[model samples]
Target: MAIAARALGPSPYGPPEGGLRNAADLIVRDAVAYAGRCDPRVSVSGEVVTGGISAVLIGESRRAFAVVLGDRGLGGFTGLLVGSVAVQVTAHARCPVLIARGTARENGPVVVGVDGSPHSDRAVAFAAEEAVLRKTDLRAVHAWTGPASTRAGDMLPLVYDPELVGEDESRLLSEATAGLTERHPDLLVAHRVVRGRAARTLIGQSHGAQLVVVGARGRGGFTGLLLGSVSQALLHHAECPVAVVRAAEV
Candidate 1:
């Protein structure tokens, strides 16, 4: 089903497009090639009205995976926009949403942010799969700090050297990366442990990344049309496109 886009609003999925051009076609093609056959694809084009939009979109694409062509204007007034259109689509869309700025490439590792939450494991699995597909490394990162982690650090070798913060994080990173290596024996996987917010650390470390993978929600399972704040923050802020994996429910 294709929508002429007579409108655009809180639709259930990404929009279908028409009147395509070479640049858009190439981008769509490259992203598809990078994502491969298992994933869905949708090309989104519309006249963004800075702070507002037409409030309705037609067509539901194959599986609602959208690549929105955003202009420079939306970046400035992003504050006025709640969580950003990209974020909204990534969070609410039925399937995964790939919001890209430039063409896709299979270079950087699929970096996933893990917080020891069940959702984090799902994200790690998602990242590992991406690494397998791209023939690249998987960087699974977990950041922990503050008082709650003190005793755990004392007992955990990775976090044992509290005074040696660098060493502490190294151990933690190793622990997280171990699972990835076992699952995808052919994959080259790595991990990092930092001391800060999950979203900020991932964004900072993945500056030149190919893709930043994350979970739609965590154990807390926060509310609203969007997922957790970290997922939302990453969608708006990450330098590279993001792949958010929501935990599969029984």
Candidate 2:
């Protein structure tokens, strides 16, 4: 389905009239035409609504399997990597939100961030399905940081073994992806546990990835926050398409 939203203005006399409606019609028409060319077997539909674009899209997202938007929209500054609409929709959408960005590499694997959160578990499942559909491997990555005291200059150095920390992180990754191979018998899955920040690690992995999948909110996210920092970072900096999956309600 192709949907377009137009911002309408108040008029004392009557409904405001101009080329905005025409522009919306043309956008929907072109989109429908393109979808038809891409796949004639699938039924295609279009709708043109009048409201804030982000709000309209978020309302429509309830029934959508995934809301796909471009990295940058028409209204944002040319230099902005991600537009305001994309960010807003991704944060509040009911389902997965995919931000279409750089060219997707045909042979790249599906990369997912695994942080042992319920949200991350959902992301892992989503990535596993995507990898199977794409006939590609799934790479689950878990990024961790050392103890906070180690980073503080004024604090006494804590005696903690780096090797033990690495092992624990690896175990976390294994647990997060425990049943993936069993669920997808034919899928190839790889695991990586890196000692770094989650956002930076995932962004680096995105360089040659077809898609990077992450939970909308991770372990560190507060209950009131819809989007987490890691997801936001990837939305702005990932080199490939990024899929932010919102965990289902308990």
User: What is the RMSD, in Å, between candidate 2 and the native fold over all Cα?
Assistant: 5.7
Tens digits of per-residue lDDT for model 2 on 190-228?
999888999999999998999999999887745788899
Candidate 1 residue 153 C-alpha distance from true site, Å? 20
TM-score of 2: 0.87
Candidate 2 residue-wise lDDT at 106: 88
lDDT (10s digit) by residue, model 1, range 1-250: 8835433333335444532343346565765665564455643343322223212211232245343434223355745433355554555554455556432445777788876555567777777887897888777787766322432225434435555765655665565456666778899777677778777898786676788878787644434434887877776677777777666551
- TM-score of each predicted structure versus truth: 0.60, 0.87
**After superposition, which runs of candidate 1 have C-alpha atoms over 4 Å from their true positions?**
1-84, 102-106, 147-178, 220-225
In order, the Cα lDDT scores of the candidates are 0.61, 0.88
Minimal lDDT window, size 10, model 1: 49-58
